[model samples]
Target: MTRAILEPVDADIDPRVLRDIYGQFPSGVAAVCALVDGSPVGMAVSSFTSVSVQPPLVSVCIANTSTTWPVLRAGRRLGVSVLGEAHEEACRRLAARTDDRFRGLDLHVSGNGAVLVDGAPAWLDCSVEAEYPAGDHTVVLLRIAGFRIDPRARPLIFHRSGFRQLVER
Candidate 1:
């Protein structure tokens, strides 16, 4: 089998034209996870953000064609693991469709059994509040149930299809 990168569509053809363009700005990686039956289902993403403060809401988008997103979205509860400098391997593993993405990854469950990935800069255990279709992706809005921030760990970043670190000014 063979594959080739598709040619770019017109400026207004796809709303997600900005998606590939947005890679110019370095973005942090995170794992959006939920428990399916007794096992963990997760997807690595760079498109997550806190959307609200008073209500403590966060959001992430998953491609409509993603097989993992459907399974992970089945539950009412989830955990968002914000990757740290040490979690590059974990990020790569989860982003692929290979066996045992959790292999060799240190993890533990929160009081609610939400998976808190070790060595992350932050973790958010949440209840999925809403989900809506947006172009070719599904935008998930969640209400935070619990959270942890690790000041000792620096957030990992991605830019222009590559993992990167910011230089101090």
Candidate 2:
């Protein structure tokens, strides 16, 4: 059978269409947090990935329009929490544009000021390594100084513009 030709994407591509296409690929949600002025400031990011093993580096993409990122990045250290299945509400709160994002949540603050969600599957204490400007977003590289994991916990997944739970067969 012959394959049909597909249209080439252009710079003027619709953002909604791009978002819908991106949402089709499932990804783990992460809470990137740090203590700012003795308060926990954080945001949820689905565009998080491990970049390097030798240097223990990870990456998270933040929208250029994000107001929280500027303040969060100023902190000496940041906590990257791989949100678990039970963290749907937490993720929502973190992503919301509210004054108190960490309200009604269990948290742990490292000595270096990395604020991590207590029940998350994994936590990485990291510092900003580098930042690169991309189209409408900034790709941030983080250097992991320390990390922890819970073997039994399941990660929260983001797909099709919604939260999803893992179903093991």
Best-fitting candidate, measured by lDDT? 2
For all candidates in order, the CA lDDT equals 0.85, 0.96
Superposed on all Cα atoms, the candidates' RMSDs to the truth, in angstroms, are 7.1, 0.9
Q: Which window of 10 residues has the lowest lDDT sum in candidate 1?
A: 11-20
Candidate 1 deviant stretches above 4 angstroms? 1-20
Tens-place lDDT per residue, model 1, 49-98, is 88999899999988999999777777657889999888888999999998
Clashes of each: 0, 0
Candidate 2 weakest ten by summed lDDT: 98-107
Model 1 RMSD in angstroms: 7.1
Considering every candidate listed, which one attains the maximal TM-score?
A: 2
What is the TM-score (0 to 1) of candidate 2? 0.97
Please identify model 2 stretches exceeding 4 Å from their true place.
Answer: none
Q: What is the C-alpha lDDT profile of model 2 across 30-141, one tens digit per residue? A: 9999998988889999999999999899999999999999999988899999999999999999999998888889999999999999989999999999999998999999
